[model samples]
Target: MNLHVIDTGFFKLDGGAMFGVVPKSLWNKRHPADENNMCTWAMRCLLIEDGDKLVLIDTGMGDKQSEKFFSFYYLQDTITLEQSLAKKGFHPDDITDVVLTHLHFDHCGGAVSLNASKGNFYPTFKNATYWSNSHHWEWAMYPNAREKASFLKDNFECLESSGQLKHLDVSDWIGNGPFPWMNILFVNGHTDKQMIPIIKYKEKQIVFTADLLPSIHHIPVAWVMAYDTRPLITLEERQRFLPEAVSNEYYLFLEHDAHHEMCTLKDSEKGVVLDKTLSLDEL
Candidate 1:
């Protein structure tokens, strides 16, 4: 199996929102903010090429939103989803499975796109089966007031309408192997039943830390996002997960960090902290 880092692009978001209640004095030192206090973050995605299946973990925000809508986030960067896939010698059609960690716009917007001529929404990966658990699907479909803006209907409804949406049973997530070579870790703190793919690769375990651990700076137990509905629940989930990640030496694949691509954790006096930083190719 071969793994590739599909860097969709970068976008800006309020650092305060990203760091939650964490003081700016602390987070500012980590990811410095611009004059407007917006911190740039990468919309990094992962691709796993295993035999006949080319699985994409998450799709970054697509370029379908209006200029006025996108101006809010200040999206930047030259690389795009199509270009990133093409660099790996694959196309959207080559993706057999799309594992959506959740239905957040930044995480799944690229899954569906607008067809200009037809004036219709369609799955970007025309042949891939888009995967999301029933619980998260329902959560997104009928989004709560807090998360409604992030859960855009256009980003996901087309997948279901196109007859390409598949629901994974949350109950089947038992033992170490839920989906052949990978196990899933579910946490409801960030969003209900958000699935984090724990992939086994080359004698090492690589975790796709989708929002649960957005960046290496978020390794601390208290660095939960403001976007999360239950901050205390997120803190508790991190307390449980970080120790295991440190003990087992898991290579965390960050989805939103701009500076650091992947990182390992170590047990420091202050708890689990970043041990080393490297790219996917270095791993």
Candidate 2:
């Protein structure tokens, strides 16, 4: 099996929103913000080459949105998804599977693209089967007022329209491998049924910490994001997952961390903290 770190690009978000109720003095020391109080973050995706299957974890925010929409997020250091795939010696057509952590615009935007000539939206990965659990799919489709803005229809509706969307059954596995060599950890705090992939690789368990743990700074129990629907549930999820990650010595693959690529957990007097940081190649 082979894993590739597909860096789609970077974007800036309000530091306050990212760190929730945590004081700026605290999180600012770790993830220093700019004059605008915005912190830069990476839209890092993962590509898995396991035998015949080529699975992509998430697609960063795409270029289909209007300039007005993008101005709000301050998207920068941009790299197109297609360009990133080409760098890996592959193309959108090469992907066999796409596992979206959730339907948030930044995470799944690149999953679909505009067919400009046709005046319609279409799946970017023409031959790939897009995977999203039914619960999250429904949540995204009929989004609540708070999250409605993030669930862009153009980013995901095309998958279902193209007859390529597949839903995973959450009950099939508790903590076991659900997709060949990867296990699915269903989390609800960030959004209903956000799926985090726990991949078994080379004698180590590498977990894709989607939005549950956006960056190393988020390893602390109280650093939950303000964007989460249920902050308390996110706290409970982190408390439960971190200890297990520490015990198993799992390598956490961060999705939104701008500088850090990956890190292992260590049990400290305070709680579980980052052990060591390394890139995916170092794994």
Question: Per-residue lDDT tens digits of candidate 2, residues 29-141?
Answer: 99999999999999999999998899999999999999999898888846778999999999899999999999999999999999788889989999999988899999999
Question: How far does residue 219 in candidate 1 sit from its true spot (Å)?
Answer: 0.9
Q: With candidate 1 superimposed using the best TM-score fit, by how many Å does residue 202's alpha carbon deviate from the native?
A: 0.4
- Quote the positional error of residue 126 for candidate 2 in Å: 0.6
Residue 125, model 1: lDDT of 94
TM-score of 1: 0.97
* Model 1 weakest lDDT span, ten residues long: 170-179
At residue 75, give the lDDT of candidate 1.
90
